[model samples]
Target: MGSRRTFSRRLGVPGRAGVALFAAGLGLMSPFAAAPASAQTADAPAGTWATPPPLGPGDAPPADSGHPDTTYKKKNECVQRSLGQDVKINFRPWGQDYLQLDRAQQIVRAATGSVGGNQKVAVIDTGVTPHPWFQDRVESGGDYVATPDNGAQPGMQDCDGHGTEVAGIIAGNPKDPQVGFIGVAPDARIVSYRQLSENYAKDDSPQQPSAPPSGGTGAPPSGGESQQPPAGGSSNSQLPPSSGGGTGSGSGTAPQQDNKGDSRDLAKQGTAGTLNTLAQIIRGIADTHRAGVINMSVDHCRPGTAPGDIQEGERKVQAAVRYAADNDIVVVAAAGNVSENCPQNDQADPNKPKSIVTPPWFSDDVLSVGAIQEDGGVAPFSVHGPWVGVAAPGTKIVSLDPAEHSNGLANLTIANGNPSPIQGTSFAAPYVAGVAALVRSMFPHMKARDVVKRLKATAQHPAAPGGRDNFVGYGVIDPVAALTANLPGDTGNLSLPKPVVQEAKLPPADGISSTPMIVALAGTGGGVAALLITLFVMHTIRRNRARSSPPTK
Candidate 1:
């Protein structure tokens, strides 16, 4: 009977037009057809010029998706050890080199005495773990991703090591010489806001049973989709295998239960409340009036989508950005690791071409950062568009790691330890944020808008067309320039020259017109003589008249 059913299914193949219609219905055909010739090149390398893979279970939602996209390099492939005894003590991350931090430090010291001193930087990500490097400077801003079961205290813990890495990049102090990694702004204070949950959705709602494809039986497949473990954690090996049992010999078979309901509930428990929670937290930060810069290394990139109209969640984030801006807080966000345009919302909307992503795309007030390689080229995975404000060193960036693994084991191996190196726009945003802190520290009276303007104006324009392309925006951030360079603000006025009073120049002696001068002088003298003669005649007449008048008196 099974063989007969399979044979019958094989006889019902769809025509080419039917296949085309199905592809169009899914909105897949247009993206491929409309893709540029460069993207469609058959000879292109495997990972280059390709759309990023779809988001998976371990990934955060679109709001906090600024985590590294490891399509180019696997997580294990990018690991590095902390500097050892024989290693040089002055080892610096490529990002620091790109920003010219040494020169910036000298300039900053000459001007402000220290780098990012007394400035508060708020890192909004997974909670930062307490590490020796940031022990004295780290402050808790409370966890926004807390669930009923997990409570809010765990929000301060770095379950996935992402937040710790980001915070370390911004302001990890160089206290431990053994771990020779230093943040861009070593003296800056860090305030952590834990917003992303450590776990992913466990199960998805089941699809209705459909007819089996050719050569397959009607029985449902065993097991659900495999879940990848979150970064820096081991896999969950205890999850039960999906039920696929059947009954025999007239015994009725009980249908296998699905975890769809449980999955939905878990998702609600974890992420349903994130948008409002994040918005409130941002407002709270602004209300504090302490944070000089807020480093939001998170971004949302919808899968299989082009940039489209704004969604409600994105609008809420934009409002929060506006709130931060209104309160004089500089907000810096990742440009996302997805290699599409910014502001990609709906994958199914054919009218929307690939563009920039939001909340950075939503407002020019926000600084949207892209990633660049050591050679100063845009990283293949860095998202691009007009909304991007600047690029930073994101590839192979070395920073702090969580102190321990989720299993309570120390997060150290013989080959590598706490100074874990990562790469993404996530880390890139912090570099810019650190620079912003330095700017704010140096110019305490400068407004948030002026600080943002200084960062962009002093950025090193790349060698691309227009000097500012969609890939790297204005170009890689120059920390020294941001610190020392004089930049114009949004309302920067030109310094006009003062009005000058010029004395009239006399002609050379040989070039003077002597004839006209003599004529003028002689005419003046003749006129004066005539006047004198008339006056004398009048006086004589008056004397004779006076004599006559005296006789009459």
Candidate 2:
């Protein structure tokens, strides 16, 4: 009923005690409560605060209760342009000001002035429209959702509005003077890949035949919840923390026990998206040199599986990410938003995450990113995990609209015809991706691993002693510092102070003479005692005199 129902688009936190606590502090409505951005008023009392309700484009209504057939159909169609796909703004969004990108840009401009001019970032999610902000920088890598017409660009059309926004965060450069929000790397190039979309899901009857496509634990946040996937979300195979796992962005609705047989089979056959396609997509990006960095805001989430029971599709994804890393490409992805389907990874042990979201769970090869609010706290909907490499401003998003006609920036998206603000880690991954671009541009010779390490090292680490935590990892990213900070990895990093050698010295000895001290102590004590004795004798004599004279009284 809301904006385009997208499986790749996550909503908010679960409807648990955590949401209630978060709402009580903020004076929000029920966990299930959701409102459009237009519903909020700026005129709340001075001491109070007002904000938009969490908007989840992925929250789908329940599927049919009837026994659905396992032989589901898959098709491809172009995502049509929509009227409310974007909301224009004459001012900058909080994220830009929060990160202070303008100042960072100024600093970099004065030095290398390489604001990603030589960088290319690949966005694998819903397709991106050719927005005005992109100018001539947006490119079509390929499409998994819709079969391209002979002349149409496969990955140029964005129906879900997800990938377009993600790319905007990385490379949008508007011509307008009034709009303050521009891409982090305004000069960088963007390659769009449409790998997932809700619009291309099930139909009562099969229409035109086409090819198929792919693909925290901190506490329960307020808006994220497990809504039924728009297309069938059930999976035939899934594993748990200790054993292994499957791949998808988030988990699907567990089929009810009574309907398990039919629902499970139907889910397996459901044509939502697949990890197999996601794997292929990454390999495609790596092999063709389409981009040096990849932003995958979309992930595969499923119920945990046994420790050693990794699925075939998941193994392929793991191998593909490894392959990318070996080729010296940086992969950045969302940490995931918490909900019933996808549990938070708040466990003390890193490996024993309550839920596993891959590419992210594959921490060594991927730079998993978490979302933080404008206030800098981890977003309530942002799920915590050991794999989180860094955090960025994910809420109160302002970016170019994917609608081909809108050609403007948006702070609000249409959810059920109501204005809803864009908030999710889906957008957060791009911030790091954008920063990665800036880093690679600044240091042309830096390797991919070092780039990942630099971003983490330059990040504002958490309060934890290790400078990292499950919640925010190394902490919120500082792009200005990332561009300018010197590191051990820097070959010319001689700015560090040289070690100073010091002569070892013994403890100071007591120097005063004991004889003088003893004499002074003896003299002082004798004088006091003599004075007391003299006073006692005098008092005795005076008492005797008074006794003789007391007869008269």
Candidate 3:
């Protein structure tokens, strides 16, 4: 490939260009730079390295908010994107059309059936745009990327233009005429948490000089184990772990080729997102009771690393997922997409993917989703792993545009001024989240674990052994089935009324009298009489034959 500009959303989709080499004067390179097989880049967008302008007089957080009052040290700023290709309002996205959400909604009766029916789903990604398609369903949860520093309201700005796309898939409800576009659960309210962003990057200044002289770069491990970047810097590196805590130098919005003749863009966008941050955000969601479901489309990925080498950040994310499940919150995450920095898991054993995408890797507590193309096949870029729970439509995505003060929708994102269809596992995760919201709404008392199981059971299972593979898991999600289907041994959390054992009412079953019963039995005696007569004749013949045939040896 001429320029490897991978733009798939977080293990990312939109707006990434070439590899983000170490900036001058930074005196450090990507931790993966020395890996002959891998490229080093965070999943940030395609912005030139421009630090946010110097902090103004009041830009500093109030002293009461914290203890330290240090000078504002500038870092490499990436001018984030806020615009997307404006699509016609009447246009219907193929993903929603295929899901048949309206049928699911009717069955669930989210708006009309019960009090507090609209389930709250939290989107922990770039902040969601306040698109009109949301119809005031968006709520600001928190902003880790742009907050006290930038003075942007918490969870209100989508600098990377990625979170808005994710949220729209979960709750967008455009009431325009003849519009087929609607969310998996239109009534499900969205709680937006700007947990990560490609706009912000870590300041690995020369003063820190944390990197060793030999540059301490290590290639991904070839062993059958998962890998994730450390918490210090570089984004979640890639999947299996949740959004990484500290991101390294961001990758550009360009496509990179894994081998030869490959056309799918797999460049991950850089963001402030990291695994530890992701873990923190998940726990926060459970603590605050903000939402019943969590959607994480961002992930930290690294080239395969040493066997049995688990990053602390990945463990934290795993704990967070368990916490969410314990608190009855359903957590859904993207099975990270493929890129040069993050290779496919095809070479690994069925259960052991060298590339571990998180919180998806923490599968028991999470519902990891893989991406599928429009034709119902697995998207080539959707990374494969055993943790994947189900698949959803990910290719050629259409969702709310993340631009500021705009109510338009978008089907494509611009990279290097060229429009490419919005596509990625990032988008797919939201689809599952939307379905999860609907399931939560319909079965208000179902346990979070049961909800996860329901999704797997209702999916369009693959033909692979055990009805799943590393790629598509249990297969594509069936929203309608998820909402209404009854499962065997479903005692997980249906919360149905207990069955009451009681004696039957006094009216006895009518029956024939004994005389009539005898007649009924006698009515069938003719066949018996015929059989007896035949037996008598056979006995007479046998007696004569016995007399004639004496003894034969």
Better-scoring candidate (lDDT), 2 or 3: 2
TM-score of every model versus the real structure: 0.57, 0.65, 0.65
Candidate 3: stretches off by over 4 Å:
1-86, 110-117, 148-152, 204-271, 491-553
Report every candidate's CA lDDT. Answer: 0.53, 0.61, 0.59
TM-score, cand. 1: 0.57
Task: Please identify model 1 stretches exceeding 4 Å from their true place.
Answer: 1-90, 147-154, 176-180, 200-273, 303-308, 339-356, 405-421, 463-466, 488-553
In every candidate, how many clashes are there? 8, 35, 56
**Tens-digit lDDT track of model 2 for 1-553:** 2332331134354435444555554533321122222211101112211111121354222221211222223332222222322334667777888888998777666767557888999998767778777888988887765554324487776644567778999999985677778999998999988676543455556565544332200000011211111111123322211111011122232221110001111012334445666777888777777799999887765555545445556666777787788788999988777655666666555445566666676676788888888888888778776567789988777777554455666554332222235677877889999999888877777888888878877888665634566778777889988888877646332254556998899889788779998999999999999999999999999999988885764
How well is each residue in 1-553 modelled by candidate 1, as lDDT tens digits? 5654554456563455455555555543332122222222111122321222222344322332322211111001111111211122245566676677767867776877777877899987767766666756887776654321222243455433456667877887756555446788888888887665323221233642322221111111000100001121112111112110110111111112121100111013222124545556677778776587998766654422432234455555666777788789999988765522233322333223254344555435578888888888776656665557788987765566443212111111111111112456777888899889888887787789788867766778655433454667667888877766643333323233566999889876886669998999999999999999999999999999888874543
RMSD values, in order shown:
22.8, 18.5, 19.0
| Candidate 2 positional error at 489, Å | 2.8
Which one is best on lDDT? 2
Per-residue lDDT tens digits for candidate 3, residues 246-338, read 111223432211211112211223325556556667777788789999898877775555444556666667667777788999889888777
